[model samples]
Target: MNMKRNSVGDKVFDCFNLTGLFILVGLILYPLLFVAIASLSEPDQIYNAAFLLWPKGFQLESYRIVMENPDIWIGFVNTIVYTVSGTLISMILSVLGAYPLSRSDFKGRRFFSFFITFTIFFSAIGGMIPLYFVIDKLGMLNTMWSAILPGGVVVLNMIIIRSYFETKIPMEVQESAALDGCGNFRLLFSIILPLSKPVLAIMILFYFVHHWNAFFYALIFITEKDKYPLQLVLREILVNNNLNNLLPTMTDQNYLERLKQQQSLKYAAIVITTLPVLVLYPFVSKHFKEGLLVGSVKG
Candidate 1:
């Protein structure tokens, strides 16, 4: 009788768990669905919507207007450049710093580890004023390097990568590689990096998102209009209400209509900005489970 009751309770608990999981998923998905639906709807219909589930008055006008703007195109190109270059530099530096920290036998390992770890907690002093002054002194202000150099490598990412290497990679395997006349560079390039695809993918996605969404850096450093990143373009459209200012002589009669449609275009831009990471997730999602398990297991 006790076993029978326990079995019934287990079944009830399982049903409740599934129900809760679906509810949580629904909570997260509903807003994105609403935004997507609103983005495709006519602005008047969208404003009327209390809870947008589908396009009330289907329209592609927002996308057309956004595409028509030349500054938007320039900013999009600048954003792509920043994201790609930033991710590459971040990965290269992160891997180099992480590998040495992974080695327990390396001299001054603790000090080096502490030094890298220290950056994670400590906020930059004088936040942007002194940084601006320093960049000006280096003559990097108003240049591409200003965006790239300030965020070369993130400390938290380095620590996670180093932890993965220390816990997952066998010291014995590295010793075997060294015996086979492999130098540190060859061992890292030929061995460790090949096996680090999952963490690297995650890092790339993280850094890409960071660089893509970065606005303040460009806003502060880049005085030149052409160097403005996509986020700055988005800011001009959304916050400043100054799309005309971006292009001084754009005297098109549809300017008011174009600005009205930016509400939908904002969400469309978000979806576009996020698409790279979304597309990438499917390719690396399977690897994450296995990779994380490997990293978590002690060497």
Candidate 2:
């Protein structure tokens, strides 16, 4: 066997790639680190540019202010409900939808797949006005369903999962299950699902993140303050900067403090909103990579 080493060109390319990767990692990590530090930092310190690498002055006032708001607590609960329920609905539907499409023996699978792909290329988001009318007709207006039902199964997620199932699973496995008298449901639950941990975990994460970060849907559908999601509450804080509801005792006396608080609150809100996903990512990220098993199975 000719066990020749990599050429000089390949060695140089590897070094170049590592350097690029290091730079890319720094580019991404620095901003995230800054957001976290800035959230814990004093807004005046940020304005002064005393330090950017770490919290210029560690302060919990912003977080305390944000947490003490009644609306924020209500919104947090509503958001948790929405994210968990929405992710469940989306994942189940996407997996079910993908299964039939993944089966090569299913007639017109290719045609149906093309239909799906075509929509991905051309699908436009429906206007909120028209969508509102439909939601109203369904009696979903001002309801959590208004947010969850409208986005039941994202087409792009379905497409990805269908591709995963189609290629990663072997036809031989299905045949063996059939020989063991396994019906479709049995084969799916007892076999495929058991084997699809990684993909399902990834799908759950994707759906969870999508629903958690969703604000526009809540903004249009939920009028009741208690029904608002965390993103909407954060939007109210960060964009509108309306802390009047939280502190009706606002006077010229403490006005400047409130203003300063809002600035820090913006960063704090971002950090608080993002913390769950950040904490969740490390657990699922390895599984997601395992799920994307390129060149691991035959068609």
Best by lDDT: 2
Q: What lDDT does the true structure give each of the candidates?
A: 0.78, 0.82
Summarize candidate 2's per-residue lDDT along 1-299 as a digit string, tens digits. 99989999999999999999999999999888887888888878877774489888899988887778788888889999999999999998988888888887889998988887787777645677888898899999899999898877788778777777767777799889989899888988888888778878888888999999887877888899889999888888777876665545768888777676667778877888888998999988888666755412335
**lDDT by residue (tens digit), candidate 1, 1-299:** 45545588889999999999999999999987887777788877765678877788888766666678788789889988988998899889989998998987789999998877777788654686889899999999888889887888888778778878887777899999999999989999999988788777777776777787788778889989899888888787777766563333535796665555656777665555556667767876776765555654545
RMSD of each: 3.6, 2.7
* Candidate 2 C-alpha error for residue 269, in Å: 1.4
Which regions of candidate 2 deviate over 4 angstroms?
A: 1-16, 124-126, 245-250, 253-256, 293-299
Q: RMSD in angstroms, candidate 2?
A: 2.7
